[model samples]
Target chain A: MPSPAGTPDADPVRASAGAPAADRAGGPAGEPLIEVRDLTRVYRRPRTSLTRPGEAVHALKGVSLTVHRGERFGIVGESGSGKSTLLRLLCALDRPTSGSVTFAGREVAGLPERSLRFLRRSLQIVFQDPMSSLDPRMRVRDLVAEPLVALGEPVGDRVAELLDAVGLPASAAERYPHQFSGGQRQRIAIARALAPRPEVLVADEPVSALDVSVRGQILNLLADLADELGLTLVFVSHDLAVVRHLCETVAVVHDGLIVETGPVDDVWEAPGHPYTRALLAAVPTLEGML
Target chain B: MLTVDGLGVRAGDLELVREVSFGIGPGERVGLIGESGSGKSLTALALMGLLPDGVTASGTARLGGRDLVGVPERRLKDLRGRTVSMVFQEPMTALNPLMRVGAQVAEVMTLHGVAAGRARERAAELLGRVRLPDPERIARSYPHQLSGGQRQRVMLAIALANEPDLLICDEPTTALDVTVQKQMLELIAEVAPALLFITHDLAVVASLCERVLVMYGGRVVESGPLREVFKHPRHRYTEGLLAASRLPPRGTRLATIPGSVPAAGRFPGGCVFRDRCAHATETCETAPELTAPELTAPDLTGPEPRGDGHAFACWHPRR
Candidate 1:
């Protein structure tokens, strides 16, 4: 389906034809937008006894990967698999205990908040639950424009433009978040993320909370927007099928480590890791079995 | 073993579910598929006479020749665990945090008239039947100490303690990981004599069920053998749902339904799905009856034939 608005002509960062061709051929040839190396994060559990140290939990262990510009990279893992920890480190939301994360050849491992304005403008995240992520007290227009306002950018007609791009009516801007349906609320969340025109879009289980029918709408919207803007997508989900639909590269994380990484189709056709095989076999599919 | 006809649930003047009818024979496995606000869970709750306060049920729901609607609470309580048991979506909430897992399973049996000593012994056996590792050790652990899958297994053990004739599972595996969910589904299929599986996942239903009922706006808009419905869906809603469930080619757009599900009690008067269906006409403003359509292909009836043919409710249907 075409985007609700006419073709987005305002943005000049459309995908270069060679980028997707290279991605389809197995690997991305574009420059690395984000590079991670030997990343590890450890957390201390709460102490249960007096005068005793809390147990140390290794959430991530020596994980390393590269996300190329204009590439769709998927991270698949179950809950508590340290996939969230990896995403947090990639986005610089959490500090890693070891290793380094570099964005466009600059280290972002432990930078202060004030010095990370460029990183903030280059990446945006859409969380799992739209209801929890979007502020309930704000109107749709202000919520969509909040990112731009925070970055000291002029809030022009970008709100209406984004609403159209995500297939929402202009009338929706006047209403509160509670007035919209779950899918509409998600569209609002996507619009809010795109307001500042970030080069990289990170979605964490974005459609997991939506209904079965509406999930396709959101996925299609994400794919369409990513292509139109040439934005690098770092999508994380537990379902391989969903990731396969949107991403070219896949990384299967299990127990704080990357168990498998390759082209999504190759991994889906023949998984090397036993955990990936088990995960693939367990996903209920309506293939010939129906 | 279970037959529901004209089942409707209402709170005050608003009807949330309307004209839901289906049946499950002995040893038959059926799936009730719907999105949120589709009234699938309410229908299961109505079957067990376990609807919440301010909500009441209508019409006849015969469970083993006994009407469940309007049944006395005392009698319903007696029939619940013994005749028909239910497993909810969240095992953590369904289980008692204060009680040990073994005691919870044993309590269901003792409440259904099994002796306390014999019930305790059977509870462990039931846990083992569900394939929970170290059943004896698991029995002594509280709900908080167990993982989500283990807790779900404990819930299954309790549901099967009295060996009910029919089991109603409402999204029992929705909150679980894929591997754990597969094991749980296998365990349920092995132990449940008859099942009314309710879930939004069409693939999960296609994997475990022989017959399927598609519910929309609290109504069973379509019903038939799983293979027939999945392959040749006549209802617009079912066709859209199946298309949406399939993964599209990478980088291509997925087929999507036009609108979101309406809020409970806010669905239109006639066709519940017409608002979202693209082929809706003025005739769709009037409700269509559920009827078996003439098929050019051979009818693929389910193994435990309930006698109902492939049926759909639509003024205009895909050929």
Candidate 2:
């Protein structure tokens, strides 16, 4: 189904069509920006002793979902539910053990390094912890400029514009990330991610490491940017309220599988799956306090 | 019961916590809420006489007629595990990786001079009390062998082993998943006689505590019963925080406080929160006293009694 209510720009397509519909619905109106079909990832731990063979972990158990262009899609799960694994595969950063991931109607799996460069430019990621992701010694200007510089794009005035767009001062570009607070450091990360001018942004618990007061600022910045640029967004978080606030459609991951998927309000107001109901109940909200 | 008055913590020339005063009645649960650098944790540390070097606490904090602040370290040691105990946020670090879970819980009892033989048996019982299934097996496992929830339960068992009159938890569930956090919160409430919970999650506080204290810029900005403070927050900072925590409908902008929390000792000399508070006026140039304006005589006859139990430290509080 098309994204209901707020996300009016969501391209319409068959809700549960098993096969790729890119050619069937050629225009952006029906073509999904990102699609995953039966994606699976298996990690094998080497045998430490000769007597033991090895250990195998099925991180993702054949998960499938489609994210339409300009749609704010969310994946919610507790730790080790394969949300991270799915995100890595969807971004083409890691190969799936089996299944297919298509970005803009092109297969993401087994792409050549040269073709993969295009995927890197089109899809960007903002990690959870900014301190670890950002280089401590590098100045903010060089960090935001790294993406453009690597892509061989001109660096003229783009850094200043990016800093301004992310609500950071122009002078901030000269300071190291260590000089900034957690919130400011995250803003810098967001600016860096946007430097490539990507169509899709995937954030994995972007605000979880931030303080309560600063969480709003970062989430608002992301929401504002997503709307202004019409960017397709994939937000992965365990926070039900946060996912409900930011996304139009949500897929609840449990036991390495998508247990439920629907409009955010539909799932929140009337969850059909047991795990989704439990997750929604566990999240304490301001309305509950009242 | 515990009572604190005019508690302040300072490091050399910098004051990190100022004029914090609250009490935990017997069997009562009180929450100290704020963002990072707001001194909520420091306040708990000061209560337990566990401040790091170079930090000095000034003010009177008495537990059951005995002074906690300014007490000699020797005397504080005697009262620590027996009178007041604390559970830190990180369960993995809080536990000793080298020791088995039972040994760790029994260690607290043995350190307090419980009979060695009795301590071992009591340790297993304490683990069972925290609702861990098959406490005997869990007691034999190492800290790393247990899941995050199981490790936290061990922490709770250790904290409650001596049955201290007061239990101080500093962001105890911040590291756990939502489902695990819910169970942990419930277990703490069930076991602790008097809890002083410090956390940044307002919803967690609302669910767990009966009373609330809002802190900002090293000061207590508001204090009241949980229902009263949450339903009708007087301080502008509390109002902003409550609004910021809510999940607005899709496409709505979250209401954010104007600026980030000020650095410790860097707050304005007058009102610490005035820089971010939109209600600030000329009068706010001077620090406002924390007073309970709504508190009058209680309506004992009414079904839900009303009294002047709420206090806020804002010159221009919300009506």
Candidate 3:
């Protein structure tokens, strides 16, 4: 197996020494590609006639992490664990209440919309539901070309290549999104995400909506694409098996906080936190039974 | 006890579930495993006589002495909650948002002629049995007030409120996280007498059921002891499904079944799985009935026959 160059251990402190000198804000080896420090997001419920005072809900609390270039990082958590909130913050889709998210050596949190063009080109997201994400009325060709068209980049034959890369035929470009199955639609969504040739790809529960038989194919495709493109992939899911299969490092989130972070194998073999242990125990496996 | 034999469900000329057969003994846990569009849910709806209008069912489905197929609506309505209860995938959708959890549980008993006052008390007890904390508070709360895990427990509590002979849970834990799912599975196992657990997850089926029936293209492709089928899957589709479930070692290509499940009514005339089967030959053109092929012990050169049981509908089965 060809591991990424300069893969770090769970301990970021130890990784400081070998980290490449910061050449461009987010530099090469040694320096992290993405750094999040003390990130927190709190949502306040609106006061209603029945209730005088509104309550504050902490969606995320003091979360800190670093994603090295070309590394597959995974965030695993159940509903209400703030995994989704964290992803939104990382992608700059939503700003945090406090703390900082530095991407490519530039702060992303609270960044102005006009200045976000660079971040937009660098980071791309593939949502959970392909059916909802892809425009039903749009042709596959136009859907794949939308990112490039928005960025003012040329869309000559790029859509065709992307479809081929994701294993979809070139002819699929002419068809509407509704004509394809769930897995095929996801492939189209993936192809669209890759059209911009982004450096970082963030996928939230990409395969959870797919059938078991086709889930493997999509996972393999994502892993292969990330490696082939040397893209820094940040994948968020509740399924530990999928994370273990595709990720080198994993962070387990619980109750709006990261409970544990470590190498995928290490965490799976001996989880450090109580929540991690409980989550692992819940996964049904055929190891002994089969 | 439930015995479903040669049960087929169809709409006009289209067959949704064809020649399906299975038996769930008293207190037994049987699983129906299949991927999307495999007719697993349709078969469950057929068992409950819940197939939508315009669709008709054939063959015999005997639940104790009652016939579920083509039964009168009035009789089926009485037997539904009192005899066989079902827990669905989405708890929130399955429950009434306007109704309190406690009242919903109590309603099942009250409809069966239990005293109104006694039904409320029993509902609380059932909630407690399903491990929902603060049964009294939960009973008063609406479905939206509780968490996903709590709502699922309430669904289980309602399903078991009548102490039905059989319980059919269709992907009950699929919507839940791993930890909550484990708890729900344990509770379901503890409370239900006989369970017909339906899911696309093979590992979950292996964990909960001793016997399993593998469905594909609206047909029961394989049926037998869970361990026996898992160890040596005879049908090509079952083998593909099992192989797909397990992730290969890191950085390796996963073994995937090439094509997706055929759309409804578009299944090939002969072998429904022939399109995806690597070993399919001309012989597969003729439809094959469920049969148990002889297995030879590996140690001996001569064929050592195995006992009869486990069956697969395939022309070329792996022995």
lDDT of 3 by residue, B1-319 (tens): 5888888989999998899887888888999999989999999999898999999899988898899988898999988988998999999999999999999999999998999999999999999999887899999999999888888899989989888999999999998887778777887887889999999999899889977899998899988778888889999999999999998767888889987877899888889999889999999988888774333334323221112247799998876
lDDT of 2 by residue, B262-300 (tens): 677778877889888888888998998888435423642
Candidate 1, residue A52: CA error in Å?
4.1
Tens digits of per-residue lDDT, candidate 1, B39-61, equal: 99999999989899999999988
Residues forming the 10-long window of minimal summed lDDT in candidate 2 chain B: B299-308
Scored by CA lDDT, what does every candidate get? 0.87, 0.85, 0.85
What's the lDDT of the predicted structure labeled candidate 1? 0.87
Which runs of model 3 end up more than 4 angstroms from their true locations?
A1-30, A48-53, B292-308
Q: What is the lDDT of candidate 2?
A: 0.85
Model 2 misplacement above 4 A: A1-30, A46-48, A112-114, B296-308
Worst 10 residues of 1 chain A by lDDT: A1-10
Question: Which CAPRI level is candidate 2?
Answer: acceptable
Ranking by TM-score: 2, 1, 3
**What is the number of residue pairs that collide in model 3?**
3
Clashing pairs in 1: none
Per-residue lDDT tens digits for candidate 3, residues A1-290, read 11111221233333222222121233225358899887889987887657576778888877888888888889998888789999999999899999899998999999888899999999999999999999999999999999999999999999999999999999999999989989999999999999899999999999998888899889989999998998889999998988999888888877667767767888888886666777787889988556
